[model samples]
Target chain A: MRLSEEQYELIEAYLNNELSAADRTSFENELQADSELMAEVTLQRDLRLGFRAIGISQALDKARAQYNANRRVEAVPADPSSKPMPVTRPLSTWQYWAAAASVVVVLGVGYFVFQQTTEQPTDLAYNETFVPVDELTKEFPRGLAPNTRQQFLDILKEYEAGNYSTAIDQLKTLPADRQTVHYRNFFLGLSYLANKQPTEAIPLLQKALATPSVALRQKAEWFLALAYVKNGQKEKALPTLKRISADKAHPFNLLAQRVLQKIN
Target chain B: MAIRPLPTFLSDQELYDALKRRDDRAYQYLYAESFPSFRHWMLTHNGSEMDAEDAFQKGMLSFLLNVETGKYQFQASTQVTTVLFEYCKRVWLTELKSARVRTKAAMPDSVDSMDTGNVVEDLERLEVVNTVQKSLSQLKDECRKLIEWFYIEELSLREIAERLGMKETSVKSKRYDCAEKLKGFYAQNAKKMGL
Candidate 1:
């Protein structure tokens, strides 16, 4: 049986130990009488255990990285001789040139290694290319119930104000009728991207690409490509970005070309 | 992100408490401190550096899971490092026995005497964890994030509301919806995995 919202909240409160002693005692008495409620509680408890396990695993991964990085730092050998060597004799001109060339080569190699290790061009490109679409509600979808339409308009205010997490939460609550589906998906996808969740953004943006409006489809395709890049799926992004770059009339043509150069 | 220095605990109890709390710094400190000796033990036990690292990670994960779940309780007599080392050693020994490497070298009597818990049961528990992880990944973005933020990150409803720009009441309702969706995914996954 589908639990009412109140029932769901009650279960959560019990699971979280947020209920009072008297209330918990009464709830336990209710569970004793209801096998279904007992089973529901067990399932909720298991789900929470699973969630906590996932959190521990993620924390362990971070710790592992930190431990490894610290080891690498410690493993680097300290130079034993800090004092400059006294010149025993004047160096020959060829020897001086050879020493100068060696210094130049060493500096060049160090700089190359540093650049290779530290530079992330695709990340730079994504940061540069992904400006959030302004005024998301400008073409507010028609035929939404007045209340629903008003709710969406309010959500757009959060979106525009850079409160993407809030926008995403409210967006998920909106009723996605046939007319509003694509619009909701597009804005939801945009909010996900703005919140640095490219993995979440990618699928929704792909769905948004099927929107009937050519202009919205173009925007969706552009954002989809950017999401792919941000998500480390550059290969998936290439075809769409190439298509955009090939069409000078496409609004994102210049931006796509620039991103392609950086990623490549 | 900047790497913070590993935190120090004044006593084994403090370290155990931190581990039970799932403190990231405690995990890091334990990992860094224990690995060198564990690596040495592994090298002497017919294992390579990679094998040592693998065994240690698996062991650490299993042991910490037990601690968080209250299967392993703190004891004043047992140093945290000693217990951690023992766990890693047991992991390597289990791997060796499974691979039949014990035939190549005499099994250490010391290790054989220790109470090494059931390896098969440990693996089964880890499998459940894997199933949960897979189910979580399959959830839609909104539901996954909401669940993670609420349950994993332990964010309060009011804190999540502030971040989402919603009222606390709305956030609470949304969390319930997301949680229900997660339960749906988990049930399907559990069935598929025969859990």
Candidate 2:
């Protein structure tokens, strides 16, 4: 049965439990009398449930991947230290002096080892935390022509494929306006960052912060901070990092806090 | 040794809001805060790391979907992590219970009396969704994208029209047509799969 727009909305409201008690009772009565209406409701409910299930499944996969990536970063050291934790032992007079000399040499190596471990966390945080945005997973921006939409998708596909240079060239072909402006700036900035052109990434990310979508703004702000860090502008990154750290709800909150601790 | 920082928010509501928006930071923060303890519980309960991981993911997806759909009403007294652990625990328990039933093994004493009806039903629904999702892949690229944008992403007709450079009226009709095509494909696939 082909339902009219109003009928579809009414059925959706009923199925979603948004209907008033009186309306719900009336709808139940209608359902009892009309087999076609009952069938249509069932179809609508199943379709919705199906979409929701699939959406959550995709999200779960992404979350699992993110969790695994984070776990891998913290689990093992790239460079193992030569000396394990020190243990105390009683020593003879001659052995004491010999041990003292060895201690000095050990201290020298200790400092180098300390430097290696300390340096790793910051770089590791950047590398492990930055999962390249999947373009197909992202909702395409509204209002492009069919060709433009295809073009945007092509650029996104290239970006996902690590062809940042080609993606950047194609991104530049897309016109910017109120609707397309944020997306162009954001994706272009991401492409630049992935291409190791953080200097070029900064301005676009800053512009992307002006987007109406809070999610897009949050993404832009995050990459903007990372861009500053990448460009060796740690001082500029500080404010954004602090802001993210302060906002407990931000997706980057914990990571921002970690990065801030390392650099500080 | 560097200590991992905890998420900044003090309340579950704030964290839930971030998750609903699909914020990666929130996802990561929740992973750090909740997964370890849940994994530990799983290990003690005769579950392996892989089992824990799978349960955690499924539980998280279920919880988030409920939150998104307004099926989960927040309780001021319940910590978000605590609730999440319960969800993960239930998923594992349900799996264990079914495994025992299938193998004719003794039921473990650790199995609680909590209901597994919703979790089982949701899993079954997920199977149907998976089947239909594969069917969606068989659709022409334009029709698939159109239906996905409108239904799955819930984009407004105006926004969709803007994206495709079509008039709102045309986009509205296109949405209907695309939905019908998707339903046709889904019905055929569902019958084939006996779903």
Off by over 4 Å in 2: A1-28, A59-264, B1-7, B20-23, B112-114, B189-195
Residue B182 error, candidate 1, Å: 0.9
lDDT of 1 by residue, B1-195 (tens): 223456789999999999999887798788767877887788788875445655676677778878988888999999988988987788778766655453576666765565656654665666566556556656776677777788888998888888788999988888877777777877777787687
Name the runs in model 1 displaced over 4 angstroms: A77-264, B1-6, B46-50, B95-122
Give each model a TM-score.
0.55, 0.54
| Cα lDDT of model 1 by residue, A1-264, tens digit | 457789888988998899999999999999999999998888777777677776776666556545533433333323433221222112121110000000101000000000111223211101111122233454567566788878887876665444566788898888787798898898888777655466678899899988888877887787777777755578998999899889998856755665675456
Cα lDDT tens digits, model 2, B1-195, are 112233467578888888777665576677767877886788789875445655776677778777777788777899878888888888889878887787799885657465889887755665565555655655665776676677666788899999899999998777777766766777777777677
Model 1 residue A24 CA deviation in Å: 3.5
In model 2, what is the error at residue A93, expressed in angstroms?
41
Cα lDDT, model 2, residue B167: 99
Say which candidate scores most in lDDT.
Answer: 1
Model 2, position B178, has a per-residue lDDT of: 71
Listed models, DockQ each: 0.21, 0.15
- Evaluated at residue A196, the lDDT of candidate 1 is 46
